[model samples]
Target: MLRFGLVGALGIILAIASPALPAAAQKRFPSSAGELTVDTVASGLEHPWGLAFLPDGRALVTERPGRLRLVETDGKLSRPISGIPSVMARGQGGLLGIALDPEFAQNRLIYLSFSEPRAGGNGTSVARGRLNEQGTALGDVTVIFRQMPTIASNMHFGSRLVFDRTGALFVTVGERYTQRDQAQNPANHLGKIIRIRPDGSVPADNPRKPGWAGEVWSIGHRNVQGAALHPDTGQLWTAEHGARGGDEINTPKAGLNYGWPVITYGVDYSGAKIGEGTAKPGMEQPLFYWDPSIAPSGAAFYTGTAWPQWKNSLFVGALAGGLLTRLSTEGEKVTGEERLLTDIDARIRDVVQGPDGFLYLLTDEEDGKLLRVRPAR
Candidate 1:
């Protein structure tokens, strides 16, 4: 009896000392979609950064610490799948994003973007791999697209993989923070959006310029983190992070320059003015921008029928703000904004729509969670 009492007392003391754990399974919250419930599908993920739903409803998830996991439907996370390339898991770098082939069921191919350790330091690179039948490992892994002039910095590896309707892959590259000025220089891949074929070849139709890389689709971007193809227009849309302010949403067109260091609505970290004011004659402007930065990440447009009111709404996960941002858009312009799930107070790293018409989210914590959003009973 004495031993049992001591163990019980210790459990209570530890619970009091530790921070509150997020509610298990399901919790209710109010939102524009009416009363909704967030179910904790799985926990104990280490900085989970990407999520890709398989045809079987399982998901391939990546941890920033260099592991790929398969999350089963019943909330079991398979052991780290084998054959992930050696990643330079440094600051703002690591295994970043993943995308499925359009015909994944047939080809079993998947693409991943991660920071690759190079001779100098590291840069973001995309790799393609085949998932074996048992789903226990990735095989035939091949490095497809590698960002140019591999620098030594660890910050600003904007590496999201998105595929267009014509099957072209769009890879977003960052300016490697310390090299923000290169974002304006087309001589390198830094700070540009590049479109390439699945086989890692530059498309013949890709934009061409004297000094621009052949794979360059657009240039003059800051660190773009969130990106998705518009459900209605099929056009590529991206979310970018500004210095101190000026978080922006942009629809990047081929060969266009998005004013970053040259023109910005943000100031530097030291509170100094940045750029030559906010506009330039030839530079493209953002569709919408946030003055106080939200540090936006993975994005998805709600096309699922689970919530009719949320249809066509663009959902973006906020890492710094610890919430989900819903932007109501018409045509190419943002009309309204709704910030939801702030009460959870977790850093939302990725937002995705499941095949079951429900929404899913990844929290970027030491012990991150895979959460599902559905209507509350």
Candidate 2:
């Protein structure tokens, strides 16, 4: 029953004030470990979705409106960089997940996930490019992977890019709202977590089912928004949206089928039953699930010494709850939960740990903000 720190009787007084407070005001909040300060790093972003820190401490940020910018530690933002491939930018489809190449320091490469336009509609796709030295343009960008059977819907493009320790890239895609049943089919890319090499090739050791799509790592996901490799074990973990309830936290393994519409801890928003039941043989179960969905987006496991008491805590940004949810983890399982940043009152689109051991967050808004959370003086 512990939060991220030592709750020394004043834990109840840690509540924050309104999120409208000026960024320069240096508002502080009490926490079990110590006081936390929330500072605005940058603003004017339109629904910023993903963040990846550069070697020099600057960050590449993506706005869902199909623009990309570089943000500095001091809150200065670069112009929307040139050379981003076109994005659909319709409904939930747009520029989404991003990550640096594991060998970025030597190769200057980066990857981006977006909803690519197709004949029928759009689907999630990943592209790689070299970031120019000045960080002003992406060069030699090429689409490496495109989800199959693009449908005529924009609602469920699960785009989160995470790189495993072995340098394999994991891309999460959702079952297009009208294609829930496709989640159960391994032959298609919808509602699936795909694993691939950095160069768009399938790995030699990837999971294989008879007639399984070579890149499909696991299937039966709804609309996964949060995906991260466990900081300790290197397993891919994800948090996905559900209908009325049934938000799930899963560590997807190779060749496994995580039942979506077939087995959910939820019902349709219209109160109609979904799937056969919550559990069945031959389908993988979530390590943890939420009954009342939180609409989780970004994920990061705190590995910072700044908050020693918070080491290894899994932090998830909630778009629906407008808060940051910290789950205490014991290996692969979530044991306890604490919701923070409630006073911010912003739909947190993505959260990442900075190079300096602090937390950085992107708010999901037209005039979205990049916020820094750190120890207060």
Candidate 3:
């Protein structure tokens, strides 16, 4: 069982296991979709994933190799910012998402997601800190939320952080590549989107039974890397990677089960079908799905002024598909889908709208890049 106390810990060193992909599955990578143009805004980064625009017109990026960087508006990359704690970078686990406190104007608080070591094992953790005067190192850091009951596996640490309009925080955790069953259990944090206070306390209004923990907002997911609240509806939306197929975009209701391994439209990596047949009665279906798997990561709604025709569309980053997907949303339904930047062929890991009204993306790779997207004339 997972324990719930707090202490400084170190992750277990992985034994250099063989690659998780099946032998026959290895092939040329970087999938691309329909035609849409993309342009590079900046280059020269190490596995850039998460992005957060600061109030000063600069943006902060988290590289999976455990570095936090400051990118100015003119595309200049600052020296690595300090104060990030140690992280386990084995497989998909590492420094993940970044978000400023909704009340950052007064508090100067920021949140981060990373894989932290713990007793008996390691798991995904969230920490908070303040940026220093020089915008370099973070100071006054504290761990707000840490997954209990660490395990030995090193894959599927979802670790996406987003602050809703109400100042409540939503965190996503993968099933750790071993606890697939926990995705359907209300008792576990794995494969779930958790809702908490900015200070890391479980809110009273969470979808818990009278005596159960209240942090669980929705359950039954598989590595949900992208989560964002709809700009007009105030509803929460998420994108998750499926096994061999069945990438999904879902709007989760309080207490709804999303049907991960139990009823997936996807098959296992070995080409075996997963779960019972799709469409279980109690589980919610995806608002949209991608077959052959886009391996989606970050997501956000486009409310910026630069893209006049995309005023309320949803932008999703694809890790496997190597493109950004634009979705049309109306009343919680996805009406149309378009693939963007298929020609660039970069692993688009995170997408966010800049305060300057342009779209930004961070690529995923050993040598990744930071890119900006605008409407082509």
Candidate 4:
């Protein structure tokens, strides 16, 4: 029941209690879109991860512990909707991302990404189901995609789902910490962006040859968590975590190599060198990178008119940096950067522009919150 003003105070206390960011990681800039205010829409969520608004103004929220709930327009949360598949729920793995079908109004279909457990081990997976008419459960659930080479390690499940204009689903996958080299292998799904039809079939025009596993769109990513289709160009952009540094924002191209372990701006956890260097012969450089990692999560392009200055800008949630990053872009290039909500001191997990022309964010914590952001009157 804490209010927004009280939440600000709580954030300040949290900043004081937590360890300070390193000098290189302290990159806070003033917002250019004038004064802004944050309102707490809902609280007491257990590590809320993904958010998607329904046509009726209610929002579908996913918690990392594998529960899905509906948040009413007035911020009341409904009981956990039934019919969710069992998730592995291990370290850095659980129910991760959720998205509504482009034609959800008609089909009532929804998609979810999670860590799926199997006999050998667990891997990232995507499932589709129809929301029951009573909104109490899901029906006709089916797993559409599963990451290949299921490994035991629980970290580095790079999962975020986005649908392209043509109705293809783009899925991000991570290189399961110990499987960095596999990112370069076309035979596996680790460290790659894969595009598939809603029914789990590979599109004939996929970049890979017919013999290759027809799902991979690009390769050599580290642990991508944030993904969005560019509002202007319709291109796919992603934000991924690095080892110690080298957090990157990239626009993935078909069949291109991103050069993760082979070429990285980050070093190992032990301060050892990662790749040959930041550059290699055929790898593509990121549109932007953070030297000290921000640990970015979900992302959205601000297409709302409520904040005209933010229109077409890219907003990403920062986990380690504890802020919302606004990247000003000119077409495909990032022109400027600003860090917001630093005073909130919450690990921002997701950012979505609401249908009502406001921005919504999910804070990651034991007592996570759904926050609304708008221009101050």
Candidate 5:
């Protein structure tokens, strides 16, 4: 069970220190659909970062300390599955994202993203492996993709994996914090979205120009964490972390410039202005932005039937704000906003819709938990 006393105290401190929203805006938005019932499905996880459900009704969860565990339908976590590649396991850098092969039933393949340590420095790397029939260890593990220009910083490894309907894969990355200026450059993979085939080969129709890296899909991103495919439009949407303010949600198009430091609604940590203003020509604007900075991580477009009114809403996990934010969208624009799970006071790491029509959340803490959300009885 969660330590309510300690968690509550942390929540109070976060509420007092949060500068992103005004006092009035910080007030919880009461759920209009019904009271939410939150249950602790699993606990004692060490900073669980990503989650992926398997074809057999079990799930795979990755810990930031470089271990992966299998979770049963009843929330029982198995012993750490072996055969994962070595990881750097530093601040904000470790095992980050996981995804199952679209044809997992036949191939039993899985993919993982982590901070790989090298002779010079560390960089985000992706690997694929086939799950052995015994379900205890991986077979044929192979490193597939590695981010370019590996740096020494332990921060800003924005690694999230998502597969489009066409069987192509998208990888999100961050501009190593000190290398913010590199976000606008195209020669490297820093601060860019990468598109490639499942086997880590460049797609023939990739939008990179003559001087840009062949895997680049979009440029000028800071550190993108949350990514999801629109349920209707089938476009790729991402949530990016801002420096001080200016947290943004964007639908990244192929070969486009997103304007990270050049144009942002946020400023530096010292409260200095950023860029030449919020708007500029040639750079793409955000579909939605947060002034104070919610520090959004994982996101999913809800299509579940359990919450009928929330069927089409976008659910985003907020770290600094310590809540689950629900945004109602009209086409590409966010029309309304609501915040949930504030009373729990935990930093939400990732959110995903489960196969059973409920929402699952991962809390970012030493004693992280897997929570299931449903309508209160």
Candidate 6:
């Protein structure tokens, strides 16, 4: 682990203190991180959102415009896979997160999170399907879980999916802008982390009681787009986008509230202060945060053998800031942070370590590209 002393760490501490940190501190990152070599492995994507790596080295990516594509190890970008369910491709709602089944070796199954269109409006849903031999067709797609109440507007669709070691699926949903107060409502699924069986059935051990509508694991999130279980501790860590300034990195506790609108490091988009204050007694505080919101999107922990020094660190993608941040951690606490691939100047949507011990990135744009980062030898 590397230590930068108290003076350097003060900037990070002050960012989460409130909304008074300077812009220079917001942009300043670690000065060094060894050699990093980045390459455009695949291109020609349309607003790529989420990504998952297969055991055989293929990559499954979701495009916000309602398409899923496979990128082979040889850098071949395959055609869009068919049989994806219809998506409400509005502002932020559309085809979102993807994850391979924990037992994918035998099942050849994959899970997806997307906006499901309904009579009244659209709601986020989790679907599972099998990948075909050529990776161009989705067979036997099944809807396992769907958000309870569909609503209008398309801003905050906190759709990120990941499976824990137990094979249970964890899905996130945004407030949907229909109801701000619904975030604290255990009866509503909006702005909550839901834990369910692979087939979409509610888990018996969900953080909430049996009478609740769905399996809400945690609540009070504005738009949590990034989520990953810590490699060492098995705890779930999330990165959420704030309205104007507050972007938070938190280790979500079961049944604990994460206070979004009520207490935030951010204000409204029009530059007005949000809620009453930045912290409250009941709400859990963030482990780390950014004042001038980076609009964090995807998250993953580095445990691959290729970069042993990077093991246990967090890799997060920034959409608004257009950078890839590597957060060094000591146990459950973040001690250091470095920004990489800022020269690419693209809205990084997702970051993951590939099967081959390399880093993979998905850019968010009309012609988004898949990038690979390896050690510069």
lDDT of 5 by residue, 287-319 (tens): 888867889999998886656666668888889
Clashing pairs in 2: none
Backbone N/Cα/C clashes per model: 0, 0, 2, 0, 1, 0
- Root-mean-square deviation per candidate: 10.1, 4.6, 11.1, 8.1, 8.0, 7.6
Q: Residues 3-61, candidate 6: write the lDDT tens digits.
A: 22112211100001111101111123222444555667788999999999777667889
TM-score between candidate 1 and the true structure: 0.93
The C-alpha TM-scores of every prediction are: 0.93, 0.93, 0.88, 0.91, 0.91, 0.90
Off by over 4 Å in 6: 1-31
- Which segments of candidate 4 are over 4 A away from where they belong? 1-30
Angstrom error at residue 15, model 6: 30
Q: Kindly give the stretch of ten consecutive residues in candidate 4 with the minimal lDDT sum.
A: 6-15
Candidate 3: Cα lDDT at 283: 92
Cα deviation in Å at residue 186, candidate 4?
A: 1.0
Check candidate 1 and list the clashing pairs.
Answer: none
Task: Tell me the RMSD of model 5 versus the true structure.
Answer: 8.0
Which has the higher lDDT value, candidate number 4 or candidate number 6? Answer: 4
lDDT of 3 by residue, 1-377 (tens): 01111122110000111111111211121212212224465667889889998877778899988889988767778888899988888788789889989877777888999999776778989999998767888998998888755877789999789887778899999888788988887887888888899889998778885433478888888998998888887788898988977888888777888999898878899998888977899998888887778788899887765445566788888787476677767777787766655545679889887766666778887778776654432
Over all chains combined, what TM-score does candidate 4 have? Answer: 0.91
**What is residue 46's positional error in candidate 4, in angstroms?**
0.6
Off by over 4 Å in 5: 1-30
Model 3, residue pairs in steric clash: 2-149, 11-117
Alpha-carbon local distance difference test for all models = 0.84, 0.84, 0.76, 0.83, 0.82, 0.79
Tens-digit per-residue lDDT, 1-377, candidate 1: 00000000000000011111133556667676577778788899999999998988888899998999998867788999999999999898999999999989999999999999999888999999999988898999999999988999989999789999999999999999989989998878999998999999998888888888898899989899899999989999998888888888999998899988899888999999988998899999898888778888989988866566667888888888587778778889887777777677899998888777667889999999988776666
**Model 1: residue 295 alpha-carbon error in angstroms:** 0.5
